[model samples]
Target: MKKVHLGLDVGGTASRWVACDPDGQVVARGSVDGATAHVFNPAERQRLGTALAQMAAALVAEDLVAVGMVGGLTGFGSAAAAEIAALAKEALGLAPAQLLLTDDIVLAFAAQFQPGEGHLISAGTGSIGVHVAADGKMTRVGGRGILIDDAGSGSWIALRALDAIYRVLDRTGSLAEVQRLAGALFALVGGSEWHHVRQYVYGGDRGRIGALAVGVAQAAEAGDATALQILAEAGAELARLAQALQTRAGDRPIALIGGVLNLHGSIGTEIQNRLPGTPISQPNSDTALAAARLQASGEEHAWRAILASMLTPPVPSLGSSVSAAAP
Candidate 1:
């Protein structure tokens, strides 16, 4: 029998789902815009569950799997993976074929690292590095985001921008180049009087922090002194993050994904310069497509075992090791 399956990718700043036939050709796709990852919110969490239900009604399927950051990596996100599996398995009450939950990086690694001699670095709202060696030994670094990790991430750039802004506001520093960029942030467009910049900064930490990278880059391109500083700082941080990964990682191809690395001079140059001669390439496929591959593959990866062993209930708090707001 031909196997038709559904794969879900609940990742940073967005929620996405895909349906694929046994041949791995995509049949349907669904997506929702999210600033703070719905898996972290109760009300929004239903968006994923509901979307899956709707997809189930539309198509007959054999298996449905949701992979990505839903793994119990962080505390609040701990149950996201299982909750999704449960919803598909229990809530939607769909007959299960093979259901699996996992971290987003693992799927990307599976899709990109065919020979398994590579490291997948995801830099977006946050950043994480996963290494798949020739022997299939996986080592992850810098996945904690702005709080603990995410060194080359967008939020990391934004935090540096904020620091530059603070430095300027306090008159403790000079951002002659970055000032113009900061002005854009405060400046308004058209006749609209909405002060989204101010509101965004004050609204919440996770909400604005990750997305701030875009604005910072905009300012830097415009010759904003402070914005350039922010980008430079982020570039350095990106290098350091890459350095840490390269040091620990054995010889492997390094694949860089997410918005931060895509930009030419700002971050890519920094990372490439720091980690010279390393194989840094683009994502072979998107996270959603990777999710679909993982969905179709029935083999249970060892990543799940690591997650289960690490998260033995009563997860440790963010104590002194990490500050409250990641940014």
Candidate 2:
């Protein structure tokens, strides 16, 4: 039987798994619904376990044995780390020594840079800046989650767009001026009624809300001024995260990662404008694959080299625009 190392990148919006052989060749890969590491929450814990089981079953069906597993999970604080680790071990059929778990941001940083080499700005469902020093100390800025405002994140952008749309309605009693944005957002929400927006915002999880960022991006692409401004502000907010980390970690190169950066070009451009002369690269490498390589090599330097070799050009947008119909 062929043995493989498993790497899992589990976030609020998506969970991806990659299996790599000893020679660092990808053997299998899969993705499932996203889950967080806040295992103390019963619902989240169940989602995490289910996602792990799904990935494990897929590997088993492919006749691959997992010898080691590394997982990077969102909300992987100390409070629920042990429980989450145990869940992964049981679901993936790995022993305690064969498993390593960490925060998703840490995994993302490792995928892009070796410790002390640079700072990482990740803007997904949430936003955060992370710097891991050579001495093994980690500094983090922002990423407080949606409740406290993960500024410049997908969720933040979605919230800002919704807030703006409603404000326009309140003042003008119509969405005529911001019809493009309003229509885009309402389409995602499934209705333009107040109850629809209220239910979607209050009844669903953060991931569901974060998904609305797509509509905001779409509206911006269609030349909606409000949507464009929101995205630009998001970029500035993300830059603030990088800047905060710079104050403590010094001026290191910045690596931007996450779905939010992929939403539009303006976010990346705004970040560059705010921090001139700072080297920023959005390396295109799979975080799960990087985790697998890291687990296989057990050496950060070796994993970093492997990750660097896989870097591709920055992601490009389709440049397609959607026509918005008023709701």
Candidate 3:
């Protein structure tokens, strides 16, 4: 019988999995509602665990054991890796020795970079920049969360847009621009008044507020100066993040990941212009494959060996959009 391998990538917006048999062919693939370990509410945390359990049960069939498994999840750290492993062991029927858990950034980085020096800036509901050194050292910047950091992320952009809407209302007092631009944005959110936007924002969770960035992006594309400026500033902030990582880790190619950056968007152009001589490449595989390629030994070649067996290229990320996946 062929051994089964499993890879899971969980983010704030969605979770995805890919399973491969010993023959190196994909046997099972699926997605589910987002589950991250960053929640503070007890009920929300329980929901996350339940979501993980459901995903695991759906992927692995009866009378079959998962020989090995790896998971790259949001808010995962040394402190939480063990807990995640325990969860997986119970939920997936895997032994402790057969599982590995790590931060989603690791999977995102590995998806685009190889066993060398490279930098990655990922923006989504949250943002983080990572630098993997030639000596196998890892350095990270940002990704602290919405309240304190994540400068270039969707939440950050949404907050900025909200601030702009307030500023325009306070400064302009029904100017034509406000009625034409900011008012239109408000309407898109189903709010006839600013207080309605406030109610909608406060009524939902962080992901709901973060989803407002989509309206901002749409406004920018429609030639809203304020929206355009907001996106430009976002690009500038992300470039600064890239520059910070490159300065410490030495100049290297940068990979951009996440949903906020459209292929034809100004953010990519801004990053390229700011970081001269540094190449920016897209990930060849999705985060699930990257996590699945992780080896028990945690060596560079071990990962490379797994990657070399891939029969197909990576699919796009599950949470790579402005709106969070509906639960």
In order of appearance, the predictions have TM-scores of 0.75, 0.89, 0.84
Rank candidates by TM-score, best first: 2, 3, 1
Judged by TM-score, which candidate is best? 2
Give the lDDT of residue 139 in candidate 1. Answer: 66
In the range 256-286, model 1's lDDT, one tens digit per residue, is 7777875437677777777778877876466
Among these predictions, the greatest lDDT belongs to 2
Candidate 2, residues 169-272, lDDT tens digits: the string is: 99999999899999999999999999999999999988899999999999999999999999999999999988988898899999998899999999999999
User: Which residue segments of model 1 deviate by more than 4 Å?
Assistant: 1-3, 33-47, 57-82, 91-97, 133-137, 172-177, 187-198, 205-207, 297-327
Kindly report which residue stretches of model 3 are placed more than 4 angstroms away from their true locations once superposed: 38-41, 60-64, 295-327
Lowest lDDT sum, 10 consecutive residues, model 3, at 304-313
Q: Return the TM-score for candidate 2, rounded to 2 decimals.
A: 0.89
What is the per-residue lDDT of model 3 for residues 1-327, given as tens digits with 9 covering 90 to 100? Answer: 335677788877778887766554576777877887554546646656876787766755533456787777776545455566666777777776676665678667776776465888987777788865544456677777787888877888888988877786678775456444565557667876767887877777677777878878877777888878878888888998899887877888888888878622887778878988888875544778655555322443454433332212245587652211111
Range of the 10 consecutive residues with the lowest summed lDDT in candidate 2: 305-314
**Candidates ranked by lDDT, best first?**
2, 3, 1
Query: lDDT (0-100) at residue 52 of candidate 3?
Result: 73
Estimate the overall C-alpha local distance difference test score of candidate 1. Answer: 0.58
On TM-score, the stronger of 1 and 2 is 2
lDDT of 3 at 121: 90
The CA lDDT of each predicted structure is 0.58, 0.84, 0.70
